[model samples]
Target chain A: MRVLVQEALFDAGAELNAFAKGDTDIGAVVSFTGVTRDVSGGLSRMLIEHYPGMTERALTQICEEAQTRWSLADVLVIHRFGTMEPGDNIMMVATASRHRADAFAAAEFLMDYLKSRAPFWKKEITADGSEWVAAKDSDEDALDRWS
Target chain B: MIDVLYFAWVRERIGIPKEKLETTATTVMDLVEELRAREERYALAFSDLSALRVAVDQDLSDFDAPLSGAREVAFFPPMTGG
Candidate 1:
């Protein structure tokens, strides 16, 4: 398991390749990448703020929970902070397991927890001004499916 | 002294990222009340507890959580991470 909280951009494809390499026991690998989206037409950029120590701890706990619930071979979570423009990759989650079901389920579980549980907040900057992105009720509801 | 940290708009409103403060509060809510009484900025920042979340010792916790032996506390809005 690897959890990375960084400001530097990462290549999703490269990370996936590296994650899948030398894993003979795993028969399936699933990856998800979250990209900064221009919700408004005038989106200039996004500023992601995170609690330095807690962000890592929360993400690791989420990943560990996923591993415990699923028979995962490996898990990789990389989340970016600081400034980013639309279309930039904000984060990625990769899960490897002996079967596709476990990999897919663990990946989704990780995403759902990361969305609400992680200590990162995003503020969208646009031509109008900057506003912090509100946590959606739907995102919170998404966790119910897992529980 | 316990380290108090704020993030996002809370930090913007509080005008600082973190601070070391001595307090006699035993719970997170009590500490918040103490901070709110300190300045108008803190009062405004903490005016709506529904819009805020708390962490005690870097773990997500409740406003009523006990602060015994806690070294750090943080306040922020609900997370919107992915």
Candidate 2:
């Protein structure tokens, strides 16, 4: 599948290479993987929440828009939901194109849109308490750069 | 009638992931007010409107926008996506 959003974690290198092989015209592939961090003072897990029907729709829309904006051969996005421990793979996005420019730009655009526009929420579990994380001003500012 | 959804902490407070409600609200704020007045749980969920974000038809939108023809509306805490 071009887009896969699930509750299970995956290996980034394996999935990316597996999806980008045997396409002679695909000269470049750019990918990004988000991984959970190991912090000494945290609760030990990250909780991710997303709307069922709407999550898939929003992802498809974002991927379609990226394809339109860039001359890419294929795009793959994987985002994992539910409770996850530190060091787990949270998400990945890969873009394949005939040239490096398109692949690079499309991959960056996907992350920008996903960060600002995707409908996922995360809560950080700390040693003493858990807190809902708020959207960062930096993330909003990043989207503004594209606009 | 519209199907309203809640996620994350908003869902925890509201005590439901989704609900179908009948309303004649012309704007999102109007619907929020109706929800807030329904009971204490709703009030707590919507106590601070600024902390809440909304989406109409799966696209993020502001609460002041009219909901005259909306089929779905979602409420959740300010997004921490990335």
Best by TM-score: 1
lDDT, candidate 1, A1-147, per-residue tens = 999999999999999999967979999999999999998889999999999999999999999999899999999999999999999999999999999999999999999999999999999999888999999999999999998
Q: Give me the TM-scores for chain A across all models, comma-separated.
A: 0.98, 0.94
- Model 2: docking quality category: medium
The RMSD of every model to the true structure, in order and in angstroms, is 0.7, 1.8
For model 2, what is the error of residue A12's alpha carbon versus the real structure, in angstroms, after optimal superposition?
A: 1.0
DockQ of 1: 0.95
Q: Pick the candidate with the highest DockQ.
A: 1
What's the DockQ for every one of the candidates? 0.95, 0.71
Q: TM-score per candidate, in order?
A: 0.98, 0.92
Q: Per-residue lDDT tens digits of candidate 2, residues B34-72?
A: 999999999999999878889998888998999988999
**Residue A119 lDDT, candidate 1, scale 0-100:** 98
For model 1, residues B1-82, the per-residue Cα lDDT tens digits are 9999999999999999999999999999999999999999999999999999999998999999999999999999999999
**Runs in model 2 lying further than 4 Å from the true structure:** none
Instruction: Please give the lDDT score at residue A93 for candidate 2.
Output: 94
